[model samples]
Target: MINYSCINQLKTLKDIIRYTTTIFNESDIFFGHGSDNAYDEAVYLILHALNLPDDNLDMFLDANITKNEIRKILYLINKRVTLRIPISYLTEESLLQGYKFYIDKNVIVPRSPISELIQNCLYPWVKNPESITSILDLCTGSGCLAILSALAFQESMLTATDISVEALKIAKKNINYYNLQNRITTINSNLFDDIPIHQYDIIICNPPYVNTQSLNKLPKEYLHEPMIALDGGNDGMDIIKKILKNVKNFLKKEGILVLEIGNEYNNFVKNFQNINPTWVTTINTEKSIMLLNQEQIP
Candidate 1:
């Protein structure tokens, strides 16, 4: 219950940010979508609503904010606290590795560690990016990774697929936003069910790996996203198992697959007792993403 009428009292950007942090903390709000903590989230929300450069927080910390602008910002904060909506959905945009993408309720926010992996072109795994000719991004929400991979491997053509048609619309919108429609194609498929006869140099996926037990403990903010992009069944390997069994067909004999199974490392090992995947090192953790070559699969 934010006192909307008192918004004018918080007149400066600095004032609003402090107030937001206090309010967010008092309300026990969760923050894992875009920003990691309340201070960063406050800065992002206030700066975004004010239509200011996100990086110029220091320059505008004490700058005066108009009453109408304060009202609008307060409205957003209220929605964020009371409704527990993610800041990206509230702002209608998300940033991954400095690249901005349009986001909405149809897809999850662009927060994958794969963004860093792709930004680095997969490092030692793939020494040369130009040699990559094709890429497939499964569960490509908002086309963030698909578009990022296309940018990373300039010579490669990308096919981004998702089971939800509504999610595909957002992905296509983002692809066109980056003017990558020419380099990326959108497919409506459940994993590999409808994928055409094509093998990719790289097959990256950030599928639904949240176990049923963990689903019950998820923060309310996560409920704002499409659950099809989150729920991964009882053991969290429902989609992972399918991908493991069939990804070999879509991956070239010499190619690699980068899969992200957030917080499911133990379950992943137990599910695939025979498979040994090279855990890809990310800023988060090595277990967050895994890399497997063609021979690694059965």
Candidate 2:
């Protein structure tokens, strides 16, 4: 429990940021979602708690906060420290490529670096970005990627699928929130089992690639997220294998598959030795995501 009386003494936004950063450092909470450091996380939490714009952080740095506001901030900060809850779930929102999406424990927080590629419209990878009429976002948790794709490829309609009904529900909420109902469709599918045999010009996924050993070692923050979203089997290639085997059936002759497999680079290379994927580079992590054309898959 947090002591409201003591927190009320912290008058300004700067004061709260410093205090929260200290508590986060002391708690040793994991931070794999977007912000990497304690100070950045503190700034994010404080800004959202105050309903202020992150870009205008400097404008609110020294702004005085009321006792009630301080109490609310402290409560959130304490929950993050003591409970190890992800800050995104605490706020029920997350940002990707400067776009906001609704998030909860029902689906993993939208943290894929693929958002960068979508924002750039997959340029250089796709020969005709404007002609991309159909897209598939497999394992589309909260439909963040699907929504982004809808915006990226204005001519495209998407089929976003996930095995979890709860995740699909959250994905629907996001699709509705973004007013992307016309361009995006959500499906409950185990890989491609429930999805119809439809071809796509592009297929994007940030699937579960965390191996069993890595899953066990994940921080308490991850435990709040669905295990189905993280566990990628013994060697972390179970879901990847299934996707590789069936993806060619749904992709057009020129279609490409973009997949994010975190920290499983070596395993990916070893498992699919015959098939070669053109690895996509992101600003934050190198070789974490890869691209494959329909012809590359056997």
Tell me, by TM-score, which candidate is best: 1
Give the per-residue lDDT of model 1 (tens digit) for 1-298.
Answer: 7898786588888888899888887887898998888888988898889889976778988899888988888899899999999999999999999999998999999999998999999889999999999999999989999999999999999999999998899999989988999999999999999999888999999999999999989999999899899999998999999999899988899999999999999999888889988997777777879999999998
Which portions of model 1 show Cα errors greater than 4 Å? Answer: none
lDDT tens string, model 2, 43-136?
Answer: 9998889999888888888999988888889989889988989999999998898888988999998889999999999999876678999999
Most accurate candidate by lDDT: 1
The local lDDT score (0 to 100) that residue 112 gets in candidate 1 is 94
Alpha-carbon local distance difference test for all models: 0.92, 0.90
Q: Model 1: clashing residue pairs?
A: none
- Please list the residue runs of candidate 2 whose C-alpha ends up more than 4 Å from where it truly belongs after superposition: 1-5
The count of residue-pair clashes in candidate 1 stands at 0
Each candidate's number of clashing pairs is 0, 0
Residue 258 miss distance in model 1 (angstroms):
0.6
Distance (Å) between predicted and true CA of 15, model 1? 1.9
